[model samples]
Target: MAHTTSHAAPFLSRAGILVLFLAAQMLALTAGAAPYLGPEDEPIRLNANVTVTGSDVRLGDLFSGHPDHEEKVVAAAPAPGQRMVLDTDWLTNLARTYGIEWHPADAYDRAIVYRSGRTVTPSEILAAFKDDLVTKGMPANTGLAPGAPLPTLTVPSEANPPFSVREAFFDPTTKNFSAVAEFTGPEGQSQFLQVRGTGFNTVTVPVLKSDVTRPQVITPDMIVSAEIPDGTLKHDIIVDAENLIGKSPITFLRAGQPVHDTEIARLNLVDVPVLRNDMNREDIIGENNVTWLTVDANTLPPDAVTTAPYLIGKSPRHIVAGGTPIRRGDVIAAQQEIMAVASRDLPLGEAFRSGDVDWVPVGEDSIGAGVIVSEADITGRVTTRPIRAGQPIRAIDVTRPTVIPKDKLVTMIYATPIMTLTVRGKALEDGAAAQTIRVANANSNKMVLAEVVDADTVRVVSQQSAMR
Candidate 1:
């Protein structure tokens, strides 16, 4: 039994040793199969959003919690100012390829990658093109008109990226140009664009600083200089400051616009007669009552009286206010003559008295020939015909007072050298004192020429005496 027990002990001991060795080997194999943990043992996770500035997108941009191989490039980055989405399948394939310990949570899981950059403005591009053009014999301060609309360009946001023109061609004769513009990116990458346009020389011209109304004088302060394209300048445009200063605008002039030669003119001034003081109708305006005003002829009324001679010795047709410019219809020639006119309607055979006539002043052209101008000539004269009130009395309108009416019985007296005879007669016609008229003898019924003596008396005269 001792011998069997000793032998079994050796076998059992050897078996235990082999078991311990195998268990140790199993632990070594398990440990070798498991993943290694670092100081930061967080799980690898998929990033939902990411932004990149470089041209390449790396594993670090699409996932977190992995730093050892995060910089490994996974894909090309999207263009500047653009975005790309990494879906679950793409993310899974990328992770497997790069050995990243990350997986999408679901099929809908995605990472949106955006590239940050800056847009090159149109003005910046133009300035670059212009600089290149200037170096290529183009005129300085030249204006440009693009042939077609320029395309938008974007570059990585860096500190003042270099923008330049390459392969530029310009024709001084035709004023045409074409060039390729290049923008250097942050990584020394370049973006090229084709540009084509026309060039024009500029000219500095005088422009109005403010709006001016018609007849308003333009002074030096109202003008300003501005640069304009030479092609836009017209032949009649006023370019000199001297041409615009002290000139009046023919019409309204707008600000910041070029003035034309026809738009401005030398001020034309005229001396116009104006009333010095208020005057009523029929009041004479003499030299003392009028004043001359210098006014722009273009702004004056068409019928305005500009001469002082026209206003002097004239009377206002209606009440005129002071400082009012005299017009052709406002005044008439002043009354300069006195003429006899009827104060009231005078019937035929009615004699005019002091109260029946008016001696009024009239213009020289108003009086006619043979018009009685003296009040004495019309006071005691009888009207030969009916005369209206305010009508002038003429020589044919009035005559001496009638001493005997027609068909009236009158005493006819015949007077000779020493003999005087009286007889009853009838007047054949009306007669005034000393006027010759026909009378008929009542007894003989014979007509004889007689001289009117009184209201009821006539003197018969022989044919020889009448003729004398």
Candidate 2:
């Protein structure tokens, strides 16, 4: 017990020595004028690239059966802190600017990486069109009728209802668009009718006023970096922001090939979607037992799909094999039919896609090449197709005319189109919108109540229904 008491004093003395060592370090740090040094406080210079319209600013025309209003919110120095504008057109432009050079490239020596099967370069089709435009060229535009084995060149027509596929092509370097149609309903009950055609074929399909038309365009100019053309693209250009910190390199690549430079450059390409009108992948084998959809409820419109273009990840669904009928739920090729905007509207520039929107989160490869075409190439008018209601839409079960009035037989009975109006505020999302409009028929001047179908249209119940 006595020995333990003596050891306690020694233990306390050792603890005091440890405290003294820590105190010395604190004194040394404060002893200096300043203890530590860090990164120098500096300002970063904000840079911007100002661009105007150019010849390569690709333009295409598409007829809006329905209003395709888009909201455009851009930051500028002028008036309002926030501005709102309604847009009916799919205005797309692409140009390259100079920045700190991460990799400067020349047009000639620089091998512009050309992605194969990226776009449908209509040159070969157009080369065929030279032959086609001669034989069946129209002074004005129209749609080609559906046919079997469609040719490279398509001619628009107004007379036909649903057309057939004309011809199909197989090119080693270029893969063409193809469609397979079969008479599933009463059209060919006795025969196993099937027809395979190319993207060059056209058809007369009904459209709503808000709908946008797109075409199957093939061009060497506008190409996709990845084989798939979703808004999200792979095979993107790496900017190397950390390595080239201060430099904003205008760097771009295509199919792993650099297109633009790290410095000032000229880029002349527009990014347009290559419409895969038919279902099968470009190189996959065609089906023998084609299955056509019913014209009644089963048919999907041209613009039926809200999602971007994608291949159905399935095998063909064959009803019969070698004329032997398979039971229900057999494994055929997977068939995915997305309602497409009329391709006729996509003559060159008129095609509208969700990918064209600026806010769309896209890969660097999607921005690499800009589509270049004239305004003539980019736009097309709405198809003169009359809107029809499926599922036997009834207007209050009105009595059929004992003596049908000539005016009642008009294609559409709705309000006069005041204009494709637009508005922005808390009440609106940009694009074309409508104001208060009255609905009436072509003959009667009496205004009637109507409901807004879309930004550009109003629907009215005929006077006969209300009177009864």
Q: Which candidate leads the pack in lDDT?
A: 1
Candidate 1 residue 21 Cα shift, in angstroms, is: 86
Structural similarity to truth (TM-score) of each candidate: 0.40, 0.11
lDDT of 2 by residue, 384-437 (tens): 233232211112211121121212321223333663322211111121112223
Clashes of each: 0, 63
In candidate 2, which residue ranges exceed 4 Å CA deviation? 1-329, 333-460, 464-468
Candidate 1 versus truth, CA RMSD in Å, comes to 22.0
lDDT of each: 0.81, 0.26
